[model samples]
Target chain A: MADVAQQILLSEIAFSYRSQNARVLDIDRLSIDAGEQVAFIGATGAGKTTLLRLIDGRLFGWTGRAEVLGRTLSPRRAAPRNWNANIGFVFQEYALIERSTVYQNVRNGRLGRTHSALSLVGLFSDRDETAVTEAINDVGLSDLADQRVDQLSGGQRQRVAVARCLAQEPKVLIADEPVSSLDPTSAEKVLDLVRACAEARGATLLISSHQPKLVAQYVDRVVGLKEGQIAFDTPAGAVTPEQLGSLYGWHVADTAARSA
Target chain B: MTSEQRISQQRRRVADWSGFMVTVTVGVLVVWAWVATDIDTGRLADSGGRIGAFLGRMFPPDWSVLPTVIDGSLETFHIALLGTIASIVLSLVLGVLAARTVTPPFIHMPLKWLLAAIRAIPLILVAMLMVGAVGLGPLPGILAIAFHSTGMLAKFYAEAIEGIPAGSLAALDSAGATWLQKLRFGAWPLIAPDLVRDTLFRFELNIRESLVLGLVGAGGIGFYIQTYVRTFQYDKAATLTIVVVIFVVLIELVNHVVRAALK
Candidate 1:
């Protein structure tokens, strides 16, 4: 064990789906310290989700030297179950079991920690139940805890997704385009909840978003990606207009005119 | 006329022509079928009196045969119940195997063909074959129902399984859920209502079909229908027919209640 502060480190990583010829991710190096918050900003197909999935250990079949949470990850095999439990992924589109109640969906996050057979039969330890309840409370969904997810509004559903991840007691939280479908007000609320949850646990947070300005406020550093490569990596406040223009292929004046 | 007006007029003309052609085609088909079956309006009119005579014979449904009708009805119910249970067990396995999401194309494609083949074989034909092989009884009827119903029920089950959202299962995978846990919490909850509704519908069909199994000596109220009609015991046959209609209606009502409760 290195006993180092770097929670995630990747070098010479490249990945592309076998069915498609185009490369989706090609990164030379990236590192994040433990408990640091980072945002990946890119347009669609810029590999933001792919990179986040890679760090979350949910993606495989890549050539890479990637170390996450002091352990080396294999490109061929999935990360171990316990290692997966230590990281929470809030997927885009909520990805909830729509027929299940909010409490059941959040309780599902404790599956890795519970006895497999016991959990299958709907038996959970008191600690697991408490954690699920607390996670639901943290997301301010205690009243809707028993309500089915399909009946919820988009914003409330996203909160349930965050609550599910929070129940994992993860050391690293990865949210992939968490607020893409939400309105501006709801988007900020979800972002705030995700960041606050990570901060409360002293967990590393990695969020991918197309809205760089909004996401930059929650994360300390922003990495701008274009066509599977890093265009710029800078402090959140230091992201330049030129970098944004190069990344999106639109000048600031054009953007201003379009908005006006 | 303007170009747009000309275009709209042409479109309307094409629609009218197609509609006119369809009506002519249907008229021709109806006349062809009428000629092929032979003109029988006079005979059909005369048959009304025969129908009345038949009704007169069945009017006083033999109350003495009530005990026999009840016994046969109970046997029919049991056969349907057992057959439905057996088909459910078989469908659970075949349905998962045939689900495109659960199995590869080669595997699911062949299993789906097998289910379709099973469905194509009529239930009565299957019951007849069962009787020839296993001899006369409810056992053969149950086996026939199970075999015949698996075709439709398994396909329905496969469709239900495929209808589950893939993203929900992936979310469970990211949560570190094992394959079985994903099935229990992710796939099962998402598909449970669909599976229940499908099973209930299949059960209803099974009940209706099983009623006719006894005609093939497979054991049910249908045996009484065959025997009474053959022996010219029209009143007794009428009693059995009435019982069957009541049973089918009751099953339909129960299915409706179950479906509503699921909602």
Candidate 2:
């Protein structure tokens, strides 16, 4: 291990679905350093999710050399055992197990780190239980810990998802449209939580969003994708209106007008 | 054209009320054909008096015969429970294999077809075949129920697994979860309630099926019903029928409780 640096590096990565004749994602190179809060902004279907999947190590059978932390990425790299302990993911739909209690769902973040067979048998160590409770509290969901996820509002469910990620105590947090389902206020709250948690843990945060305004508001750097390739890599303040227009084309004016 | 004329024209193009009406008509026709073939309303009317008389005889349910029927009903429950257990375990594996989200088409399609073939065989025939092959006992009944249940359970389980949000599995995969780990964390949690509810529902169905299996000498209350009816002991026959109904209703209640807990 090369000093266990907090960075993700990808080079010559390409991915495509079985049904897709053309590649959905093709990246020549990309890197995010330790503790960097990077936001990916792109038009719809611009391979934002695909790139996230590449970093997350979900897409296989792709031509690529990537590394997260000190581990090298390979087609033969086994599905991550203890990957959850190092990387946390928040999904667009929240993805909290609907049938599980909020506590159980949050506790799942620790699943990669927790002792095996014990959690499977529905038993958790006292330390694990405390971690779960603290995670729920961190997300401001202590009152709803016992509630089933299906009963929760969209915002609450998103919090539960955050709590799940929090429990993992990960080194990197990757969120894929984490608040696209929420109202504006709730979206802001989720973004705030993501920022706070990422900063508190000194963890690298990589979030993908279609909303450039939100990304500009919270993220340190912005990486724009257009047609499955990097369009711009710049500091959040440096992402000018012209760059935004080039990234989204004619829709940038519509987005700016709507924001106005 | 007037606004009303334009609106009506658009409605004519967009609203397929005629198609809806045709679907309803076809559905009614199909149902009518089925009823005409399988049901004899006139014969039912003629036999209503005898049925009423039979009901009168079945009154008080011969509670003294309860002990005799209890053992068989318990046997039926045991058979269903064991069969459900076996089917649930097998279905989990087969269902994952058949699920397109979990497996490649080359694997999923064939597993799906295999389950469909299993489902195509009627449960009674399966029981009969088991009885023929394994000799007359609850074991054959259990085997029959398991086989029939494997098909139904696998089909439903595959659908349940498929219904899971792809995002969670993607997240798990990204997190480096092995296929089994992905299933354990991402897929299993989402589908557990559905699996439990479906298994309970299947168990209820199997209980009824075990009765049918009794005709093939698979020991249960159905065997007693067949024996009493054949021996012309109408009283014992009525007693067995009442017992079976009560048993089914109780199982249904239990199923409801299990579903509630799972939910």
Candidate 3:
């Protein structure tokens, strides 16, 4: 079902806050083909998140000709009902319902596809339940499916977030700094689970991160952002210390020394 | 010492003086309140002996009116329970509107102020109004408690809603959740326990308030207590008081166990 049109295309995109004097994001052009796993990496304020948010359809009031999933995209967070069915977003904090079980959190991912009345009453169809169970198994949390999210460990909670997105059966999956808040081992594990799941589903995965080394192995291409603009878009293997130094405002010699 | 240190010391002295001034102002306000209310310390001292004599008469504990005491206590409990249920139902709706995170300022501000305005009037005052409007019965007392408690519970609920991570709301919002769906998935889980605890706490307070509403002819234990007191039936009033104390203890024990379970 992959169309010839790019999965994501933003041309002459510029977003600014009306309250602020300067624009936070100003991208000349960017495009991602269907099923491409791309990583956006840069310093803290480099608009990596802004770019992902735009494609996720959670941002508004942008000057751009944006087309996502082969349709003209609005800058607003919503369009026609179910416009966001194909896009799923995973927040940095896992964002699993602390008071709810892993099963419910994962099941909620398919909410957009279901009848609103069913979800309003906290019910899910058998089809939704199957997808949820499959995703829970995919994330290796099937044993903890009935367990409350608050009862789980941090890494386990992050896995629940990944499972939630996977259960959505989305065509485009966006994860914003997914591993930034986890311990090193947990971070690696979450990344592995998310990367493996996205690949299996053949979803267009867009991960934003400041840790280049962590994301390099997961993505085929890396787009380096500098002050709200893409400084470089290259194959992940082609990224080097020099480009990294420029993205994070590190001196060339300092980055080289660290690498050496 | 550095000039900065000397300046810091001077600022500390000024802050201490300001704190002292605030204490003095509070003291003055207290004095003003006592004066305006015409609280007679002499009368309080004079009543000490009478209070002792009254307690002396109650040492044998009259068990004859136990049934009446129990009946009044049950009525009070019923009123409190019904009011609590109604308050929680209404607060759940109003609280979402009061929360600034999900609601726009236009809606949030007015709802917040309305809750505050409702809360400004004491439950007993509301009960009196209800009694006046709807005849003397438990219905008026229950309605009074529900109306007043709605404001109190809504404030607590709104705070609980606002206290959780704002990012959680964004997570659900990004999922293309409807407003009700966002509340179900985002807000409900975060605030459910707190809302329950607050409701229990309000119910405990409502029990006490319901009795007072009864004193104002709103119908409950307070009506019996008022009748006993007016007719110098101190032993019966004392029995009713004992029942109320025991009832409150029971409610607190339930609250403690329920709160622990929530944890």
Candidate 4:
């Protein structure tokens, strides 16, 4: 088994957009352990997604360090060709390339591991074809594999996105609001899929969502953020209703009143 | 209401319609006046007989000239094909430079202006200029067609790149794809169909442009037309016109097949 104590670490990271004169992200220190399911909950514009981008090394112009699987993040550093081979990301919008077929979209996850220029020029590899089909099957989207992504429903597209990540066979899965755009049933099913996939692969799961109830039910740990800063980092069962309110700027009474 | 009141309302509505008609008549008259200054309508009417006489002489299209035009028509097709291929290649590079997503505004703005300037020159004039420099035949025609095609293809390619869905790019970036990888995976697949369609359309346009280029001593069926017309061989000119039409129809059929295959 992979060591559960091994962690992805981000230290003293700060980033700002060059086009805009605002500090979009700031983090002093954060660590996510392997095989742990961590959820980030915060209000809109709290930089939840930005932090995720930073960890993935998508956002540059940042100070300090981000180390994933012990590799320090740097633009000059070629991400281990296999870096994404072991790290899967589910975008908030379920960013499946709309023009491509479901099989092609899922197959993209294997890009990091595929043989180089020669294979691409020849345009056929049995291994890639099999992996892509298996991923579609895993997501229960076998019937829709040949369909264009734009033709799928919102929920179906989201499943395709998840299948893409699954195809990567990652050891760390990062999903930003994987279910926010989904209906309640779809949302539950997506969350269930993410949890089951992470547990099965023994991968650390870091998912961000605004819904506290879903997080509490599905995640093993919750990392709450307020104003781009961590407010609570605790086991899911230990996160009180007061803590959830503070994270979202809602009072417990208001939430309870609304619920009643 | 009384009949008198109803008649008065009808008269007001007729006045409104007459007012609108007067305004439209005045607008038409102004435009007609502007157009009539350089145009001799009386002379045009008088020359109708001469035009009809010329048309009558163009009949009995000399079928013997058909074999001669086959060679010139093939040359025109070659010019269009080579020009379109060259233009598509050059434009792809320039288009990437002009795309705002790939290049900063500082780079994109100047490159866009250069393309605009290139497009400003008429293709016939371009062929004439090349004739002055390179001297006659298909080379000048190819160069002219290529220059015009570059402007059009570059503009279309840049727009196609810009229209790609943002989600795929964001996803690729998050996955740590390099700029080249992002272009290969995220950008190209989305824009390829549009690019292919635009290329086919440009090829169609280039065939017509190549015929015009032949006016400036560039080798094409237009060269044959010029020769036949200068020698007052109306029958031969008519034969060349028919040949050009046939070539265009055949090319259009090929384009349809290529487009279908690409789709």
Candidate 5:
């Protein structure tokens, strides 16, 4: 177990955007193995996003021994400004450039690895073209690759975002509410693509979702979060309805009680 | 019954009081402005006959100097075009420097203040200074318009750039894109249309300012108009006035179409 690299190892991590006392995330211990697909399950304001942001280095003041992809985070200094070449973040809002073509949006995923001149001038090499084509193909968007991202449906746009992530060829992929914006049918299709793509690349996938059952069959593990701490970490198949009810305590005790 | 009688009635009373306060404040401000400007109906009644006499003199506009006025009008248009182009190019550069998303406060704050300082100086005053420096011509007018417009355009560009949401910006950052790359992909798409619209507006505004500068001897249609009126050639001045009005109306129509197409 120790031989293989730990993709994420955050312990006793605490952070707050407002003040030292008003902590938003206070995870005591969290770990993910290489190539592990883990889904974080929590209601709104339950530190799931804060945890993801902490790993992504979007949030700072990590009060404890927090390390990501083997790099140790420091309390005295903020996280180092390095290119996150091996990590992919799928934002909930689809975040694709509205005016840019699907190919152009997906090509942005390769920006981390592409030469500055190549990316800015948009003079993609044969290799760059191949990568972009492959990513578009991966997301099943080849027929509409020339279309602008804003022209696509909500589901198609999410797929484009996933394609952009796949194009990055990241070793660790973190998706924040990847399916929340999609319709029921679209959400299923998007999740399948995300799962299949992650498996093909063997990337360590960490996704956060408010709905537990929505992602139960897709992710191998479900980590429940409450308030600012980890409430439970269990295999996806084993998460009981009661556990989900307790996790989403924002529904209040009445709702949880009624559900029980 | 209690909700209506006590709560709703109290809310209505509060709203009426606030409305009355706003009305009285506006009334006071308007009265003060009227007093300060010495505006009186009695004075307007006294001046009506003289105003009518002046209007009568402006009629039967002389057409002999039409060619000279045309030359001056073209110069004004050219000044506005050249100045707008120069200012827009400079705005694109300085706007990026001043953007909060792109620049740290160390750079952004200083650039913002400098732009504000540039805007604080009246364009007419700048034109006068340039006229003195360059020794009288539309060159000074062009330079003055460009100088004043740079401050305005850069500020608007910064606002447009800042209005872009953070989610897309964060996506670009996480993808290992550099600051310049992020701006190119993230900021440019959202801001380009607005920047184009703002450039058109500045051009229109600069055209009017160019005419004003011409009155001060910076050399445009207004220069001819000022010279004509001073020499008691009201007819030629009236002709220039008609031409200027027509030119401005045409430009405004073009501006409307371009802005609509951009949207």
Candidate 6:
């Protein structure tokens, strides 16, 4: 019963590239109950992206026990297609098919749910189309649904990415630096949309970002990382400036200057 | 002068020497080719008169062979069409097998070398062998074109597959797309235009090569050219030549339209 409530649980996770001796991720333990919205804040090379990839079930060759949505992940083999559909990932680069229309790209997210043979020949049920339409409308791109993704603005492209992920109806949503390339205004809008959508669907949300102050305002929990290890895990807005400064290796004077 | 100036002077001297060597090599190669190939300026001058006589005979082409010319030309066009279609099918399979992004190096590397070896064989040589094995006709011509063009078409397709941004496929994979779905959604759209362009280019080349296949009795308008020229029926050969020119121009026009539409 306890496992039923836990959306993600990890223990004794340690990972490193084959060519590197230093571990890239060494989290001792992590647990997130269903519907919890969390953010991972770190500087560059802090393994935030790698950790998100691991939780998304894409990263391989790591030593760890990971359970997401009550299914334990095998380190050697890839996750099953249904399991993958259950955990949608939003890439930092959006990763939309530039030549495809927004509606088509969003429809791709429904592939795992459709009949494989039918989808191969571009056939989809009405349910799939309905989900795709709803996702596009939810992202406020219903008018631009027929337009090619390459013509869209960066913010619109990210919104399309969100729509694609939303179409999956995932139980746990993971975004890796989804707003890193956007302007501040767009970033806030995207972040607000992501959190709001997660809340609307009652899905567990996990996002990684470098902007701690800005990101903390979105998620209820913030887990700060420093060189592949968790430095602090506290409630959002409860993370002190000194803690963030130290996590990013800022001197006391630098922190004082930033506070001023 | 400073050491820096000395180094600059040395580099300039090296560059000048390399340029001189390259020019000298090219000149020597040209002279060697002319002498080794036994090209004679006097014989070339004498041949102009014979060529003029040949052209005079071909001026009023025999229209009596129009039916034969039309039939042979259609055969050639059919051979090219079938060969291009067959090559496209083979290229799709071989191309994916040879793409480094699709398959590991151990699989794709050997396949690449095999494709290169196929490309190295001349089309005429392949056609000759096909005629020997298949007992001549359009079958040999079709087989030869299919075999010969796959070398280039597959390589072009492999390059097209490799040109896709890796992240696009990875994104699909993360979204739980099956292997075929990833290919359909991720690889297909990005490479469809490139594949069409390559296939059209190969089709044009196949048309040209199939024209000559008839010289070896593999079947095409080239057979009439061979027979008429060998039998000294220059008037008939001239008619076949004109029809061949029209066919080639028509194909080129269609190819241009298709490529434009793709764009």
Best candidate, lDDT-wise? Answer: 1
Q: After superposition, which runs of candidate 5 have C-alpha atoms over 4 Å from their true positions?
A: A63-67, A70-83, A250-260, B1-64, B89-121, B132-135
Q: Write the per-residue lDDT of candidate 5 for residues A123-235, one digit (tens) a residue.
A: 76777678789989998999999998888999999989998888878888889999998889999998988889889998888889986778888999999988888988998
Q: Note the B-chain TM-score for every model.
A: 0.90, 0.82, 0.88, 0.83, 0.86, 0.93
Computed on C-alpha atoms, the DockQ of candidate 3 is 0.56
Candidate 2 lDDT over A1-260, as tens digits, reads 56556489889988777898877888899988889899999998899988876677666778878888778867655545675468888888887777778987887777777666666666778887888898888899989888989998999999999888888888889999988889999999999999998899898999999999886788989999998889899999888777788877857777577557
The runs of at least 3 residues in candidate 3 whose Cα sits more than 4 Å from the true structure, single-residue gaps closed, are: A1-3, A80-83, B1-50
**Per-residue lDDT of model 2, residues B151-203, tens digit only:** 99999999998899877666555444455556676778788878888888888
Clashing pairs in 3: none
Which pairs, if any, clash in model 1? none
State the lDDT of candidate 4 residue by residue for B54-167, as single tens digits.
Answer: 999899889898888999999999999998998998999999889887799999999999999999988888888988989988988888888888998998899898887687
- TM-score to native of every candidate shown: 0.95, 0.84, 0.90, 0.89, 0.85, 0.92
In terms of TM-score, the best-performing candidate is 1
How high is the TM-score of chain A in model 6? 0.97
lDDT per residue (tens digit) for residues B15-116 in model 3: 999999999999999999989999989999999999899888766667799998899889999999998999989998998789987699999999999999
Clashes of each: 0, 2, 0, 0, 0, 0
Q: Where does the lowest 10-residue lDDT sum fall in candidate 3 chain B?
A: B167-176
Worst ten-residue run, lDDT, model 5 chain B?
B213-222
lDDT of 6 at A113: 82
List where candidate 1 sits over 4 angstroms from the true fold.
Answer: A1-4, A256-260, B1-26
The residue-level lDDT of candidate 2 at B132 comes to 90
Q: Per-residue alpha-carbon lDDT of model 4 for A1-260, expressed as tens digits?
A: 56556568888877776897666666788888778789899999878898887666566667887888778888445465677567788987888787889988887776666664533443537876787787788778999889999899888999899888887778888999999999999999888888887888788899999987786788888988887778889999898778878877778998676445
**Candidate 6 deviant stretches above 4 angstroms:** A1-4, A255-260, B1-24, B42-46
